[model samples]
Structures are given as C-alpha cells and as structure tokens.
Target: MTAASFTAGLRSALRQRFRTLALLPRLLHSFWQTSPALSAAIIVLRLLRAAQPPLVLFIGKLIVDEIILQTASPAPGPTLADWVESGRLSAVAGWLLLEFLLVATANALARIGAFVERVLTERHDNALGVALIQQVASLDLRDIEASSAQDRLQRARTQRFMGNQLLTSLLSQAQDFVSLILFVIGLLSYAPLLIVLLLLALLPTLAGEAHFNAKGYGLNVSVTPERRQMDYIQIVGSVAESAKEMKLFGLGAYLAGRFAELADKVHRGNRDLAARRTLWGSLFGAIASLAYYAAYAVIAWRALKGELGIGDLTFLAGSLLRLNGLFERLILGLTQITSQTQYLDDFFSFMDLRSTMVAPSNPRPFPVPMRQGIVFDKVGFRYPGKGAWALRDLSFSIPVGETLALVGENGAGKTTIVKLLTRLYEPDEGRILVDGIDIRDIDIAELQHQVGAIFQDFVRYHMTAAENIGIGRVGCLSDRPRVIEAAQKSLAHPLIETLPEGYEQMLGRVFARGLDLSGGEWQKIAIARAYFRDAAILILDEPTAALDARAEAEIFERFRNLSEAKTALLISHRFATVRMADRILVLENGAILESGSHEELIALHGRYAELFALQAAGFQ
Candidate 1:
C-alpha cells in the first residue's frame, strides 16, 4: 500500500478506537454503581501516577546541582556553604526527598490499579456474557440453524476476552503518555535539541511493531477454518454423542491423529512468521540503539565544553532513558489496540444481525384456551439452500381434543409438519391458524406456551432427572410434585426409581455421579417432559422409536388416557401404533396422499395400504 493509503487506514482505525472508548464511560458508570468506592480509588491512583515522572526528573537536576556546588572551589559566585546558609540547598534537598516518596507511592498505586482493574473487568465481562447468551437463546430456531450463525457466536466469545484487554491497555497508555509529555518539557528546558532526537528515535520502533501486529492478525484470519476443524474433532472425540461409537469402532486414535496434524500445520505457520518478525525487530532495534547513544554522546561532549554543567548532563541523560521507555510502551499499546479492533468488529457484527423472523409491531394476545384446533391452510416451506420444497401447498386440520396420526416414509415431510406447528420455522406460503386466527398475529411467547412438542432427536440435558422432566412446563420444571406426576403419567417414574438417586440423579455421563440411561429410558423422560407441560396441544414425533414391541404397545394403550382433554398429533412409521388414531393422514413427497381412519385408508388401497402391508409382510 502507498503511504497515503496506509495513513488513511490508520486514521480510520483510530476513529473506530475512539468510538469504542466512548462506550467505556457507560460501561464504567455501570461498574461504578456496582462498586463506587473501588472505582473512585482506581481513578485517583491513575492520576497520581500521571503526575509523578516530571517531578522526579526536576528533583534529580537539583540534586546534581547541589553535588556540583559541594565539590567546587569557592568562587566569585555564591559558595556552597553560603547557599546552604541562605536555605536554598535545604529547599532542594527537601524536594528531592518528596520526589523519592512519590516514586514509591506511584509503584504502590500501580499495583493496586492492576488488581482493581482486573476485578472490575471480570465483573463487566460476566454481566455482558450472560446478556448476550440470553439474546442468542431467544433467537428463532431457524436462524440458529444457518451456517453463518456459528461464526458469529465464536466471534462474540472471542471479543469478550479481547475487549477487556484492549480497554485496560488503552487506559494505561493514556496515563503514561501524559507523564511522558510533562517529562519531555522538562528535558527541553535543559537541551532543546534532544526533543527532536527523541522523536526520531521512536519512528523505526513503532513501524516495526505495527508490521508484526499486522502479520499476526493476517495469520489468525487465514487459519480460521483449520482452527474450527480442530475444535470440532476435539469435541466429537470427547463429547457424549460420539464417545460410545468412538470406543466401539476404535476411531479415537484416528481423530486424535487428525487433530495433531492440524496443530502441527498451525505451529509451522506461526514459527515461520515469528522468525521473520524476529529478524526485522532486531534490525530496527540496532538502528534505534545507534540513534539513542549518539544523542547521549553529543550531550556528554557538550557538558565537558564548559558551556554546560553537571546538573544539565544528569537531567538530559535521565530524560532520554525515561522517554525511550515511555515511547516503547506507547507503541506496543497501540499495536495491541489495533489487533483487538478486528475482534470487536466481529462481535458487533454478530449483535447487529437481524433475525429473519421478527415479531409483529403489535402482536395480539393468543387465545386463552385454544377453543378451536390448529389448521394449516395451503402451507409450504423450503430449506434455506435447498431447491425442493420440504412441504408443499398442503392443507390439513385437527379438531379440539382429538388424536391425529401422521404416517409417512423418510424424507416425506412428516417431521417438517411438526416443526411448523411448533413455530420452529415459518411457512414460505399460506398461514397456520389457531382458533381461526393467523398464528403470526399472536405473540410468539404466548403461542409457544400453548404447545408442547417432542421430536425424534430430543435434547437430553445433563441435569437432574426431575429437571429433565420439568423442562416441559415453563416455570413448573422445578416443582417436585408436578415433575413426579408428569413422569408417572408417561410411565417414566418407575425407570427413575431404579436409579441410585431416583429423580435427583444426573442423566449424563459427563458429570461426576452421572448415569447414562438406555435409549428407551431417555425417550420415556422426553415424553414425561411433554406431559409435564400440560399444554393445550401435544406433539409426539417418533416418541416410541427406542421402545421394544411390548413397551410401544403399552405406551399406545395409555396415550389417550394420558393426553386427556389436549389435542394430540403423533408422527410414527409403525402402522399398528398409528391405527388407534381417530384420523390418519398419509404424506408422500411433501403432499398429503390420503386422509381417513386406518380402516378407511386401507380399503382405499393407496399409499397407506402399501406402507402398512409392507410392515405386516415383514412380521409374517
């Protein structure tokens, strides 16, 4: 890039940094409310440190003058003894002592500042983290399933860590820069030419540091895919879903080897970049060191020429050393802020993404009791990137307090139907209605409250058994009696009683004292959760998949009694289990092929008859 372009980019980056800093006050204000005394103390300590450097340099010059006077022969000028008698020497000595005390005080204050800043930053991070997570959890299920959503989530987490570090570094650098400016002024009063030399000395070091930072950020962005792959492998190798299969198939070693290969590639790339950076950094250091010592030599030579004195030499030399240290720290801080800005961009981008499914400007309250049943009026839907529709322009309805069964082959849109009813995804065409009102008009939260659903792939939380069941009902998940009653209704209570801790036992092997339940047992727990909800509409999708013949038979026999007054929709492949439904709908390739009672459909000799006969033939 040309110099002009680079300068413009740097200016833009600085502007962005200012914007982020502008946000810091509101953040700090929040912190102050939480802990006012500590925040005030931290601000005071920073101010004190900012005032210490110039005072120390001024006192050092006076002490050098006093020493020179003490060693000189008595001349026409005021003698050392005369000056002491006049109290000038006493005043200089007192100032030197005070400077020493401030130095010690600054050090103590710095340590306290470090501790307090760390504690407060952590507090802020935790609060923000919780808020962000809550927002993510509230997003529509369809939004979360998008491919780009995971990248946004990863950026948010990384930004939280980098944002804290950037804030602390920026604050510390501001204080140091203020102190450096004052010290430079004191040095200029003694040797004006040294000011120009100090600026020249900082240029090469800053350039070199900026180059290294750019390389690091470029490397991080380039390796994102590799890093993500490595992370995925690690999760699969260690997490519950893959643990049993990994061991049984002896695939652990293979996954570990893949992980190591990616790690090695990352290490190799980093090593090469580091080597190049070290070479350039050393070259810059040599050039800077030459300029620094040359300035020192000129100052020393000028002092010996009788045009300068001992105090002048001491002040000039001390100021040069202090300026170099301050300049280095400032440059490093700038580099850190620049790199962290990219992470901040990623974070804000995630927060800025608009959810595709937005609530209406003024949502209507849902019907209190769902007097009429749900109706899908010519509904259709297609996956985000797929060409074919998962559901076509199909219309269906179920009456209140009735059981409807959906039977279909794999990829026949049966599960997609349930998802739409649960508001997991919005239809591309037409609308679904509850109580003859469009579902979109109702408040989403209220709509969800009235529906309970169990999917083929239900989440098995790594929590206590009671919690697992209680999650079906909003706010009643923790009510012990309600949890037990739900579990009993679903025929899951007997299975829980067999465990060591009964309903309180942890349900996943990842935690200490956790027990992994059988698939059938887990399915029962999921059913219990749905039962616990006590929602007006209940959906069971392949709820009997893990059960044996006897268990499935028993579950179907108790289904009507357990459901009671609620409208139920069951999606299953087993003809025998679905035969008990008041009405059955046969779906094929995103369209309803037939709808009737099982005997009526069988008599039609259509898709339902074909599927039912196939299963019966298997038994024969």
Candidate 2:
C-alpha cells in the first residue's frame, strides 16, 4: 500500500519479465528434445485450428447473403419442394453445404489437437522430472545440505508440476493470438475506431491483471518456507515411520493443529487476492461489454441509412462481437503467460546451477596398493553459517595395514574427520594426501572408490537384503556370492537367513511385503556394506553402537581379521573396541591430546586412560 513498496514491486515484476523472456527459448528447446515430432504436430494442429474460426465466419456471411438474394427474386417458388425442384436456390444450398463441411472439419481438428497436446505434455513432464533428479544429484554435498539450497530445490521441484501446464497455456495463447489478428483485420476493413474503443476499454483490465499476478507470485515466494514445513508435517503425520511415536506421545492433535494454522495463513493470503481480483474484474468486464454495444449501435445506424447491405450488417456485427471477446481473451492470456513464466524462471535457473567441486583435467589414477599411507596435515574446517570450527589444526596419519582407533566424545571432531576424508567437505586449510600425493590430484570418484565407510547413522534402505549390501558396490549388485560373503563377515548372514524370503525379502516397513529389522540387526546389515566394498581403506564410525557387548565383540573380531592387510580407521566410545587398535588417538576439541598403544595410554594416565576408566566403571 505504501508508495515505496509499490515502486519496488514494479521493478521486481519488470526484472522477472525480462528473465522469463530469456528462459522461453530454453523451454522451447526442452520441448523439442522431449519429442520433435510431437512438438511440430502440436504447432501445426493449433495453426489449423486458428484458421478455422475466420473461414467458418466468412462462410456464414456468404450463406446469409445468398438467402437474402434468393428471397428478393421476382418469381419465387411457393413451396419447399418447388424450391428444390427449381435451380433458383442452388447458390444458397451450395453455401449451406460448404458451411456444414467447414464446421465438421473444425470439430475434428479440435479433437485431434487436444489428444496430441495431452501426449506431448505428458512426455515433457517426464523429461523434466528426470532432468531435475539428475541436476540434484550433480550438486555438491555442501549445497545439498545447506538450508538455503533446500529452499531453492523445493521451489524448483514445485515448478516442475507447472511446467506442462505452462506449455499448454503458451500454445493455446498462440492459437488465440492468431485468431485475434484475423479478427482485427476483419474489423479494420469496416470500422477501425471500434477496435480502438475496445482496446481502451480493456486497458484497466490488463493493468489490474498484471498487478494481481505479480502480487500472487510474490506471495508464493514468501510462503515457500512455510509450505515446505506443511509438507514435512503432512509426511510425519501420515507415514508409517512416525506412526508409533506419534501415537505414544499423542502428537497427532498437535501436528494437526500446527498444520491448520499454517494452512489458514496461506488461505487468507490467497483469499484476499482472489476477492480483489474478482471485484476489479467484474467492473472492467462491464465497461468492455458497454463498448461492444456502442460499436454495434454505429453499425446498425449505418445499415439503416442504406449505406451497407443487410448481409454486410450481419457480418460486421458478428465480427465485432467475436473481436470484443477475443481482445479480452488475448489480454488475459498474455498476463497468464507472464505469470507462468516466473515458474519457468525457477526451473531453468535450477538447471543452470553448476557445482563448484572440480576434479583435475588429467587426474592421477587411484593407487590400488597404497604406498605410504593416508595423512591429514593441519586440516581446519568450519561448517556453513557457523562461527566455531568443527575441526581445527587436525593432523594425523594411518600407516599401511595399521588399524587406528579415534577416541572422542560428542563434538570432538570424530565424524567431521570422516566427512573430510571422504571429500564431502573441503578443508579451509591444509591438504589430505593418499600415498604421499594430494587427494585433489586424484579423480574424486576414484579416491572415494578406494575408501569405504560405514557411519553410526547408516541408511536402512527399503530393498532386499542383497540390494542393501550390494549398493555399496553398485557394479557388483548381481554378485550374490560376494553379497553373501560380505554378510557372513559382518555376522548378518544368519539374521537374513531366518527371514521368509532370505536375500530376496524386502527390508524396512515402507512397502507392503517389507519386514523391519531391529536396531542391532540393521547395524549388522549396514556394516555388511563396508565389507562389500572391499576397498583399501575402511572406516567404521561407531558402526556397532546399536549391538550388544557379545555381538560387538564378535563383529570387531571379524573386522580385525578382514582388515589385517588393509589400513583402517575405527571410532567408538567403548574401550573394549578401542583397545584392539594398533594405535589409540585421544582427541579433544578437534586436536589430538595424546597418541599411543592402549597399554601405553593406560600407563600415561592421560585423557584416554581417564575416558577408558569411566567406561570400565559402567560395566562394573
């Protein structure tokens, strides 16, 4: 309502208009790529449909003129049969038949065009969906995890649903535009001033539509975060994953009330816009209608003065009436397009995003038998939007075939180290070297392929037991023998064998025939994935936190044997698991406080010994 705000909104709308205009070509290119034949077919069909209205109207005029000419005949036939018998009414009959044919053809064209457009829109939707997924996948881990990036992704996803509809609207408007041009030519030949009057009458309507459309877009952008929250609440309230907790805690009513509050806010915003649009729309419509009648009055008076034929009067009247409606339609359609283009802007902008992480153009291959070891040299990192560092001045190394255990409490930079090793987050300062070469020199994919990791919060995939393990080495998903071997190593084979379908049985409760596993059982399945990888460097970050003492001991024994020839990193709070490592690292606040064998640390009575004693006391 303020002058400053209005001016700002106008500028924003103008910018959006220009940006969307730039995106139009890209949209057309996407449509063509989806299916060139279908795209061309739709355009040709619309063009044919556009030409039909003008031709049909012209034929109707001819039919009227023929009837009037026959009616004025001096020796007219007295009966219908007599008229048919004589050749006097042949011209009228011919015009009538031509008009019938044109009408039939127009109907057929309309039906076919609708069918073609439907098919095209469906194909385009599918194409856009695939592209969206691929684009998301190509983004960096940092971008995917950031809150701002998620908002952009949500907007992009919502826009995909509108893409097909926007396509249809654009093509339909193009059809209408062609018809409008033809109608304008028809009017210009007779009364050009009527066209001017119609345009003037609809100016206010056009302005109102543009302003409201811009306001609607702004409202949508502002409510995106709330809309995302509503979606999350809906999922939590409806899905099976949260059902048990929701029932036990009686959160159902709370969630429902929260959702309603957000929904009402959104509803009020939309309702206000709709009410304003309706009021202005009706008033503008009345003015347009009044202008149409005024134009008709001029034509009627001219006909009465014998300046124009009865047929001319009829043709001009019909054309003017159609032209009036056409002008209104064109204005409204153009505004709809300008509004829809904002969504197009969201989608194409998403597509334009490029990841910042880049690999060497000529990268070194991964070392199969890594020579020296892995080293982190004075590495420092801080998470986005955080002032405090997650890891700082962290320097450590694991020699070839050595099992290093990292002992750290929560927020002690244990998981952050793993994330850094996997190149999920780039260090603010320092270098990670594998085999004495900077990891940046090696291809990222190749580096990752050599390091296999299983964290505490591992994924419980809703797939078969074999697939859950096999996903770790996707190329070997069909290698049943390898999958079984990995499962056996992690003590998961016995658990899976007891299931109804064994390896083929689905895991997790997301599907109809799925069987959910307990926390300990899921941990075993997750550990199986790291074994399945068979990489040179293995990382187990509290992977057995869910297991019992006996189970944990059994799993670690097997891991020790399998990793005898492989360099590995182990992170666990349990001293029982930590004692087996070749070297123990006592980390506090992102820096190593002490390093030694378990016996040596126990002798020193440092942070490690103190933590070990505290854990040992719990068991006593």
Candidate 3:
C-alpha cells in the first residue's frame, strides 16, 4: 500500500476502536463541572503516589549500602568504637525512620486516591443515570418504540454503572504505570539481571490475564439470550400484574424451570472457561516460579563468591518482589480496560442513536390552548419493516369543542390514529395539521405539551400515590394541590383516602411500607394521571376496562362533563360509552366503515350497529 493509504487505514481503524475515548474530553468536562474539588484531589493524590515509589526504592538502596559497609571486615571499615563515637548508629536509625516515613506517605496517598476516586465515581454515576433517564423521556414517542433504538437504550442502562468504575480504574492504572516505571529504573541501578528475571516472570501472567479477559468478554456476548431470558423470568415472577396469573395458571414453576435451565447454561459455559483459564494460569505459574528461584540462586552464589554484598542481595530480592506486584497490576489493569471497551461501545451507541423522525430546523410555535381543531389530510403510515400500511390514505377532522369516539375491533388501527394525532408517529403518506399548520412544522415539545393520552396498557408506576398522578405533568411533579384535584376529578381520591398515608402512601410492594392496589384502583390512578396533564387534546384507550359498572358509568359521566367544549378522542369497545360521543367513527380492516351519531349509525345498521348490538346483548 502507498504510505498515505496505509496511514489513512490505520487512522480509520483507531477511530473505530477508540471512538468512545474521543468522548473522554466531554466526559471529563462534565466531571470537572460537577465535582471540581474531588477532581483536583484525585489528581494531587495520584501525583503524590507516583512520586513516593522512587523515593522508597532510593531509601532502600541507601539502607542496603549502609549495612554492607557496616558489616565489612575491620581493615577498611570503621570499628565498633569508631562507629559509636562518630554517631553512625543514630545516623542509620534516622535513615530507617525516614524510609518508614516515605512508606507511610505512599500508603496514605494511595488511600486518598482511592477515596477521591470513589466519591467522584458515585457522583458521576448518579449524574449519568439521571441524564440517561431524562434523555429517554425527551425522545420522540415513535423513536422510543423503535426496536433498534430500545436495544441501544437497554445496552446503555446496563453499562452506566460499570462505566464509572472503568473510568476510575483507567486513571488509577495510569498513575500506577508511572510509579512502576520509576521503581523499575531505581532497581535497575542496583541489579540489572533482577529486572530481566522479573520481566520474564510477568510474561506468563500477562498472557494468562489477556486470555482470561478475552474469554470473559466472549462469554458475556454469547450469553446475551440466556441473560435476557433470565431477566424476563424475573420480571414475570415479580411484577404484581403478572403474579396472579403466574399462580392461578401454575406458570411459576414453568418459568422457574426455564430460568434454571438458562442459569445452568450460563454457569456451565463460565465454568468451562474458568477451568481453561485455571489450567493456563497453573502452567504459567510453575514456569514463573522456576525463573524466580533461578534468579535467587544466581544472587546467592554472587553473594557467597564475594562478587556481591549480603545487603545487595537483600535489595535485589525486595526489588524483585515489588516488580512482580507492579507488573501483575499493570497487565491486569490493561486487560480490564480492553474488556470494558465493549461496554463503552454499547453506552455511546445508545447516546448517539439517529432518529427517523427529525425535528424541523426552524419549528413553528404552538399557539396555547389550541384555538382550532386537529385535521388528518390523506394520512397514511407503516411501521418500520412492515409491508402493509397500518393507516392508509385516511382523512378526518376533529372539531374543537366536540367529543369524537373511534370504535373498532382489534387491529383496525384505532390506536394508530391516536398515536399519529398525538405526533407520536409521523405519517409517511400525508400531512396531519394542527390549527391548519402541518404538525411537522410545529415544535415537537410544544405539540406533546398540548396532548394527554392513556394507552390500553398504561404504566403502573411503583411510586407514591401523589407521584403516580403528578408524573403526568412532570414539570410540576411536586404540585400537591394539583395532584389532589386531578385525583378527585378521576374519582381516585376515595381510594387514596382509604390508604394509611393518603397521598403519601406507597402504591406498589416493591419497596417497604408499599401496598398493592387492585386493577380497578390502578385504572383510576391512571385516569387521574391523564386528568392531571390538563392538555387541550385528550385521548383514552380502553381506560375503563378494569372498573366496575357503577364506577365506569360515573367516570364516563365525569368525563362527559369535563370534556365539554374540548377536543377529545375516546377508543372503547363499550357501546354505552360510545353512545355518549357526539360522533362515532367505525373502523374495520384499517378503513373507516361508517361515521355518524349513535342514532344515525343504528339507522344505517352497518358495522358500528352490528358491534353495538353484540355488546348490548351482553348487558341483556
């Protein structure tokens, strides 16, 4: 290859491998801003730790030299009387004290480094966790639902905790490498051969560690399915909604068996890998031990032959031990970093996901209170990877100050209509207009702010009663009076009143002092959440499914009163609720079959009438 081409290829490879490293500056900037004092302390402690090792090695060599001179024959060396008279004993004792001081200083600095790193890591973890959750919240609804996007999100959540540890470990390793180099250079001046022997000893351990790390990462990657299955089992076995069915249907044991099978598969794979690693480690360990003893024999022979002093032998042995520890730590740290790079890849991939539905560069402002109604003009949409359209060339308008109901069986695209109207999904074929302006032109945040929706399977948050309702308007999540008012509006206040702590009562059994709510009560809480939003456009999808007849009727009546002069869309299978809507649109096979008031639809005797009669028969 040409020199330029080779250089370009190398650069590209590095960019691919170390893309997350490129983001380190930004990550460090955030850390500095969040905890400047802790960051400074870490840097100072690391520098101190780097400086202390060479000082200790220098003091060690001095002590060794002093002992050698003192033990030498009386011809050139000072006699015991001369040594005492010259205060040489006190001088040696002072040197030993200084050496001890240096050792103590090194240990203290290391402890300080650890403490600072721990504090910074915890702070970074909390900040990143909150940031990720907020990013997920801010994402467009359709983007959040995309399978690839969700996969990235899951990966990010998994790596977030470990990412902080990886960062701190990298910093510590860098500092330790500096210390190791200085210590080795100091030892080289005393015994060069010992350095060579120490290096040889480290090679086998380094090789074993590298292999172990690679195997561990491979095992993690291969067991993704087993891990996901185990997680699914845990959720099904623990969640309140699934608990009843799990027991009644006798699915608990079945799920437990599946979980055990997956666990066994993972355990066996890990055990096999560990056994191989152990074998490699043992073989290398034997070689390393032999090399060390050979080096020891050479030092002892040199000392006996008067080629080296006894104190020099002691210094050589001590340096060899320290070198072993230093090299092992260096190799282990490098392997840890290599393995953690995969986690960093996953974390950055989530943060960098590209959205299909991009916001406009210059979005139009959404007028407050939505003076006009919403219109769908030749709207069509297809989910990603689907061959057919969920909604095709459909046109409809919901006028202001009116209640519109969409009645359809499953898979008739009723929910899709609400999703598009709320701008959760953009139409591929045509435009949806809000106040006569294309929704694409409006600010996404503003558009979402004007809408409130309750899905068929709404989330049952494991939080306090007030938080469950207040989260609907997250910006005002602590507004107690507003939460209470919303709860009252949805007839959930009575349920809250029965709780021991009223609004402060925990709503799920996941935490201490938590109480589980019945399905009907949870429905009321969800309804209150929608009510708390107080948006201009409201959508309810099977919101009354869990309510008793009396409660359902009362809620519908309250909804009717609350929705007066407001634009609302209701999706329900209950004929009684559909009858209250000013107009009903009957959908079949992804197309509108009929649209009229209840009486008009009954007169036509179309799909709407047929479905209505079928439901009415249930009541009879």
TM-score per candidate = 0.88, 0.95, 0.88
Candidate closest to the true structure, highest TM-score? 2
Per-residue lDDT over 343-433 for candidate 3, one digit per residue giving the tens place of the 0 to 100 score: 7767766766655677889999876666788888988888878888898888888888788999988999999998888877878899998
Candidate 3 pairs with clashing backbones:
none
Off by over 4 Å in 2: 1-8, 74-76
- Candidate RMSDs in Å, in order, are 4.1, 2.2, 4.6
Candidate 3 structure, TM-score to reference? 0.88
* Ten-residue stretch with the least lDDT total in model 1: 19-28
Kindly list the per-residue Cα lDDT of model 2 for residues 270-302, writing each as its tens digit: 999999889878987898899989999999999
Q: Report residue 131 deviation for candidate 2 (angstroms).
A: 1.7
- Candidates by lDDT, descending order: 2, 1, 3
- lDDT of candidate 1 at residue 50, scale 0 to 100: 89
Alpha-carbon local distance difference test for all models: 0.81, 0.88, 0.81
Q: Give a tens-digit lDDT track for model 1, residues 1-620.
A: 46786566556555555555454554456567657777777777787888887777878888878767755745434666876676656766786788879889989988999998888778777876876787687777777777567766766766767657766776788888888888877877666676677667767667656666666766876777788789899999988878779999999899999999999999999999899778867887777677678888888888888767888778778878787778778876776676666666666566666667768788987776767888999999998889999999989998888899999889999988888887878999989998898888887778888888888899999999998998887587668999998888788999999999999999998799999988999999999998888888999999899999898888877888777577899999888889989999999899998999999999999989988999999999
Candidate 1: lDDT over CA atoms? Answer: 0.81
